[model samples]
Target: MSAAVHSERPALLVTAADLAPQALALLRDFDVVYAGKSPSDDDIARLCKTHNPEAIIVRYGKIGAQAMDAAPALRVISKHGSGTDTIDKVAAQARHIEVRAAVGANAAAVAEQALALLLACAKSVPHLNTRMHAGHWDKASHKSVELAGRTIGLVGLGAIGQRFARMALAMDMRVLGYDPYARDVPPGIEVVNDLDTVWREADAISLHCPLTEDNRGLINRDTLARCKRGVIVVNTARGGLIDEAALLDAIQSGQVSSAGLDSFADEPMAGGHPFQGHERIVLSPHIGGVTSDAYVKMGVASTENVLAVLRA
Candidate 1:
């Protein structure tokens, strides 16, 4: 832990203000640099130029080609969570740098968040709470949707999606899943070959897939139009999956009953964004995987991924 010894060690850059103590303890041999929260591409590039780190742990910002080029010694970019959409994979590949994700590290946390959002939307939790706070009880007139016999369509059957499916099944709800790459899906989930089947048959739809160019804006006007009327939508995965404008239109037209969104197409969704004041849309500032337990798990997983490549 001496300054001289730390200076002699290889550097590792973490794109976050702090990491879990458990993860930090594992990096005792490295000189770790902390990039303050909300670092931009230029800030990360500047840090890379200064530190010349052997590895980078992506937590809060996008890592571009410039940042990768700035660090000639960079061999790996490890994601602190499951999503790697923020990392420039093409640039990493071209530079012969490896990109790894702490897959399933935050599965439980994210799955729980998805469930919370789904339930909130189904039962009108937020709207009811607002009415209660304002002393305008309309309990006699208000009706909540029950979930026991409902069918929920899940997109992406990864660890997080599977976990949420189990929870939904426990509630006696039918589950329909659509994932082209998923194999050996758990029992009780009816796997559908196409998205059209999911949209047509499901009463509610939840997204749990990664953001990719092929699937960007997957839930758009056309897809929403195919869905059953008054269908509930919940997105706990990537923001780019849903077209915000189309979703707002669907909500306004009553084609979609309600929405629970954790991630947005743009991070730190600017003030006065269109989705801000909607009563039926519940929003969280992309904190689905930010629980204390998941934070420690992700940090440890990301650190281990870094060490794996560095020690290879």
Candidate 2:
């Protein structure tokens, strides 16, 4: 086959295997080449040799110095989601290649998913479903709590956290928030001064903070120890924020009632993963922002970010 032509508009290499067509349609002016599946680092380098795209969009997998070295002609990287942790920023900076993250585009969808997990965990939907499937009708024996009178503590008061607080208030749940960077907590949500304050006060705690070296594993055993005995935890944010082993141990010991995890430290968690058999945990295949609306928004936003850099 002839190599993908490098046109005047630009050639874009979409490294992600599952980018929606709508995202591609938005960038139709450019030549779009998709990797049949997620390409390995060497495969990406080989593709760069042939296609010579001006921009590359990556999702989920890491983009390291080796990948960058292979595509010196590449000017931009359009990250599909809010997180840029997987992209090698140091290499991009040194190479003078612009990198763009589609931040805030999927906050609403992700925050909504977090709340869904909290409610599902509290109501024991998975357990009830399993019972019904097993030829047992024990609905009457299972007790479920309502969110109306309970308290929800938000870990980060960023866009997603603030959005969650609004939803919680509408449900008549008390919302408490802790964010050192936030200027003021949203109206109707109580602003707490420290991380422990949220843990001690909340019946369900949702984490919405960014993952950084300092904040890695912030929700470890010690933090979980301070929470209410039956506190439901939701983390739609980055995976490194919670210590997976510590969380599993807490769940087994009944220190943590249940958890809703959208992101994991490792994606496509290996077969026979511990969480596979856990009924209490609500595990999404990182589909928090997998909605149609979020996909279009992120694509358009990243497109803009890319165009801005080229213009500059």
Candidate 3:
């Protein structure tokens, strides 16, 4: 594509610095603007004002009312992944702008990550690995928890949750799920209507829910207190779902034996954050759904979502 030809196309702003080539091919008719990684609300608003894009693809950063108001031509906001909490839906609706998400596009990757985290927490993988690396092998004293025949409670039985349940069942584990909105839940998953049952019964708890006003800090001090003592916790979902301070306290007090976290209350989890260097907690940089395959899937899904509205 010639620079002159590209400049003549309708503009599309992407929050991320880069996009997959496969997804870019679908945007041939649009001139895409890359908002460098970690773009602030001010940067996004400035870009929207300068570019006057017809659509925005949200992959990172918060998309607030200011950004929406700046782009008078903006008609849609498409999420590059399933989570849409970062985008201001109320503001978009008020502005008559449509919001769409690449729902389930990254399900497999995130589900697999949840399972990995569960196993890491249950079997003490990181701790053992670190010990071995430091030339301190205490194989005789180390006792790993076995998952077979143990109950695993899952919150939010969406695509990702259901996928993780299937994996857990294959490993000879009991699967209990809690999701009021889920319908036709596959066989073998014991769906419990009450979250209290999940907290009391499960040996391990995994979160696969989205972040919302009603469910923010769902795993706070009170909820943690209700959980079975020494329970393993894994969260590949939104960080707001869990209270970071409560989780740390639970770990320190032995209410939660171990935790595997892929997301945080804040992204790029600031330097010297409390979660840093915690032995019982294993952390990942919110990349549970960031696999290469998931990247392309999410990118394509987000691009298609934008086109659905723009070309309607």
Candidate 4:
């Protein structure tokens, strides 16, 4: 609830309170609502009913049709990150609300995180650390492979994937990509039309693809079976790209040697997930795009989009 005196300003609702000061300063002219940690969909709907926000800044939360129904004044939904899976696009379109994303703002951060995950999986960093913490130091048992001579396959060569390609190339790794619409790929990477070749050839495969109805579970049992035996998997993209159940089975059978995942299909993964406590898997909360620099850039872009739509 607001404690300050009232003034004439546009109502703006931010679904997260962790927005940087740079982004907050941009919203000085607007009456803002900040959803604290562990926010819920019910909170969003309740806030809209209480304050009637004309614009919403969505940062990693599920906002449904109920929230839209509560806020009849809402004109636009601006996502702080690139993905739109959290927001209900079909419902928003039905309500005639403009939904947009802060694209490319967090590309570098996400790309860097992707490489970190890939390296961590290849070196078994998490496993070694866990063993050491448990007072067991068997150094020679865990073998680390050199990344220089191996082939790395990228599912999508968008902004983040392009950056990952550069990093891999710097380490002398051969990078292959599969993106049907990307016309101008970077100089070093080879973009291929055939998807099977990536699964068959890549020593390690990283996913940078978006999640869609047609592409959901793109890495299912059939696709995982097609991969080279003992292949490593990395995903810094949306979770829906890989079927968690299928991946778990592959890992158990040694079909997939290791995995580094930052996103999952049913997110905010509950305790005792299939990947957790596994020596071959490294997991992170979906925070690849949570850097300070990305926050400011995304926040400013989202605010700008909101303002543009409102002022028009």
Q: Which predicted model would earn the best TM-score?
A: 1
Candidate 1, residue 39: CA error in Å? 0.4
Winning candidate number (lDDT): 1
Prediction-by-prediction clash tally: 0, 0, 0, 0
Q: Which 10 successive residues of model 1 have the least lDDT summed?
A: 1-10
Model 4 scores a TM of 0.93
**Cα shift from native, residue 295, model 4 (Å):** 2.2
lDDT of 4 by residue, 176-250 (tens): 999997868989998889889999999999998878897899999999999999889999999999999999999
Error of 2 at 79 (Å): 1.6
Q: In model 4, where do residues sit more than 4 Å from their true spots?
A: 1-7, 134-139
Q: Is candidate 2 or candidate 3 better by lDDT?
A: 3
- Provide the clash count, candidate 2: 0
Provide the TM-score for each candidate, comma-separated. Answer: 0.98, 0.91, 0.97, 0.93
The parts of candidate 3 lying over 4 Å away from their true place are 1-6
Evaluated against the true structure, the overall lDDT of model 2 is: 0.82
Candidate 4: lDDT of 126? 84
Better of 2 and 4 by lDDT: 4
TM-score comparison, 1 vs 4, better candidate = 1
- Residues 1-312 of candidate 2 have per-residue lDDT tens digits of 225675677667777655666666667677777765656777776667777777888764577787778777789987887888778888989998888988788888888898888888988888888888899988677788788989999988888889899999999999999888887666998998888889898999898887888999999999999989988989998899999999998899888889989889887778888988898788888788878889888777777777677668
